[model samples]
Target: MSMTANTAMAASTPRRGSSIAWSDVLLNIYILIFFLYLFVPLLIMIGAAFNVNSTPSITDWQGFTLDWFTGEVDEETGRVIAKGLPQEDRFLQGLWHSVIIALGVVAIAIPLGLSGALVLTRLQSGSTTFLYTLLISPILTPGIVLGVTTMIFWRDIFSVEAGLFTTMIAHSTFIASYCMLMFMARLQRQDRGLEEAALDLGASNVMVFRRITLPFLRPTILTAAVIGFLQSMENYNTTFFAIGGSWTLVTEIGSRMRFGLTPVINAIGVIFIVITVVAAVAWVFFRKREKG
Candidate 1:
């Protein structure tokens, strides 16, 4: 009887294994297709960047040239001129401007977001709901509307020039809302007992926060900061309205597209992709190390 039962169990095990294998195969195929759909355009763009002759015509392959990285072609003279034309550094300058603005946004957003999140966490039922709605309202507001309102507000109230400063403020207003939301969500899952115990042990409010809350919230804060920075850097609609005459990497690329598309843009895109991928990989490895 025992031998017969063992044979039946062994036969059932093969069926279960086959089902799991089939599920895994289907899941892997789905993931492969999804990744292909997401990455194919980026792959094509990166490939085109290395093409010596990048043209407006996607179908027509001009023999590969590195001229776009080097210099611009003169339209009237029909000569490959290297002087008095915008080159790599011009694009880099715009990228630098974006970085500066993004950094500013992060600087302003993190403290405000963390404070707001902490306050909201302590609030009672009625005030909590109202505060939550107010905090999140900015994220829900349309970017175009926020940009226009910011432009109007700054112009009317402060009489400030519409430029990088205004653009940073505009981006920060909405991006900070997102940061607050991210931090608040993370804070909800946190153990507040450490904070209470620290306070009970006669620690000052500031000390309790510094020793217990801040360290605990550091990862969420960092995540929110990165998200805010990326949002500020890539923002177009708000930046467009608030930028006035100032140019950013996004604006420069958009403006230059009218004259002709160049491989330099692709080069820039590839660089961005590579940097982001490396950062993501490093983050994963660091996270694993921390867990270990």
Candidate 2:
């Protein structure tokens, strides 16, 4: 009887192993599919950047050239030999505008968000919920609505026409809410006893906030600023309506798509990809060092 039971148990162990192996194979297939879905387009885009084709495409293999990035011009006639990023003055200007707006958004959003978060976290009252909802309503509002309203309000009230200034304001209207949420999350986990003790020890409210609270919230502030900047850079609908004739890098890209598609766009994408990858790698290394 003991030998029969041992043989049965051994057979069941092999059956379980086979099942586990099959599941592993399925999981691997799913992972492969997901990665392909993400990277195949990126690979195609990168390939097209190096292609000599006037139009950006990987289907028709053009001869490889770096003209899209470095550009080409006939020195004798001063004619465009190969249109490149340097020749795209509007695109370059738009990129500069995007950086400026992003910086402005970060500047405006961080302070407003920090104020809202501080109030919501520290002020214990029934009205806190109402105030929180009011502050965050801008985020829930449609981008179109925000854009139109911001444009009209500034133009009517402040005599400010739609431009980078209005665009920054529109972006901040929603981005501040995002920053506030990040700040609030950080504040919720804070040890309030330290603040209380500091106050009891004759520290002024401002001193306690500067030394204790600000130090604790520093990470969230940096994170919120980054998020706000990225949000401002990528925003299209709100920016489009609020900016009027002004444009950002994203808007310029969209405009180019309407008239003609070029490898320069692909070059821009590749540059962005490289920057993002480098930043991510740097962050990983920094985090590892921090942990160590």
Candidate 3:
């Protein structure tokens, strides 16, 4: 009887394995379809950047040209235009402005976010929930509403001018929440004993924080800084309101789009996409090396 029962179990195992294999195959096919759906638009955009013609339609394959990268001149007006390519000083200036603003936002947001996360983590009361909601409220708010509110609050109430500083502050308001949330999540899983051990080893509070807490938080800090920088750079709605006629890369792109779409924008997109892909690849390698 025992041998018969064992034989029956063995016989059923292959059927169960077959069912799981079929399910996995179907799931992999769905995932592949989903990835292709997401990737096709980006591939089309990158391909279109290399096309000689700037038409939105992707049916025709114009011979590859680099005119979109090399600057062009307006024949009738004799004015230098962003028509053929996007290498003008203005675009460079706009990119520089974005970089500066992103740096400023990171500088202000990181410390504030770290402190906020620390406070929220230490608190153990009902009010902590309210504070969490308050910190994250900006993320839920519409960008346009945030922009308008920022403009009114700064310009009318504080009598501040719209410029780089205002834009940085506006961006930091929401971005800090993202940083705080990332840190808070990391902190939740962190072991407190390491910090306590450092304190017990005759280390001063500042020394303990510098050597122990900061090192542990380095990954989170780097993640937050990168996230904040990217958010500030690509932000359009809040920056648009706070810029007060000041130009940044995103705004410049919007302005150029009003005249006509150009492949130059695609060139810029391609540059950024390449940078992002390279950075991600490097990060994966670095992580693997650390594990090894």
How badly does each model clash, as a count of residue pairs? 3, 0, 0
- Give the alpha carbon lDDT tens digit for every residue of 141-208 in model 2: 99999999999999999999999999999999999999999999999999999999999999999999
Q: Is candidate 1 or candidate 2 better by lDDT?
A: 2
Sort every candidate by lDDT, greatest first: 2, 3, 1
Best by TM-score: 2
Per-residue lDDT tens digits for candidate 1, residues 74-193, read: 889977664212455566787888898899999988888878887898777777888889888888998888888888899999998888888888888888888888888988998988
Tens digits of per-residue lDDT for model 3, 1-292? 9899999988987778777878989999999999999989888888888887777435687788767777566789877654554456668899999999999999999998999999999999999989999999989988877777877788888898888878988898999999999999999988999889988888899998898889989999998999899999999988888888789999988888898877788878778789989988998998899898
Global lDDT of each model?
0.80, 0.93, 0.87
Ranking the candidates on TM-score from highest down gives: 2, 3, 1
Worst 10 residues of 1 by lDDT: 82-91
TM-score of each: 0.79, 0.88, 0.82
In candidate 1, position 215 carries an lDDT of: 87
Which residue runs of candidate 2 sit more than 4 Å off their true CA positions?
A: 1-20, 284-292
Which predicted model would earn the best lDDT? Answer: 2
Evaluated against the true structure, the overall lDDT of model 3 is 0.87
User: How many backbone clashes can be found in candidate 2?
Assistant: 0
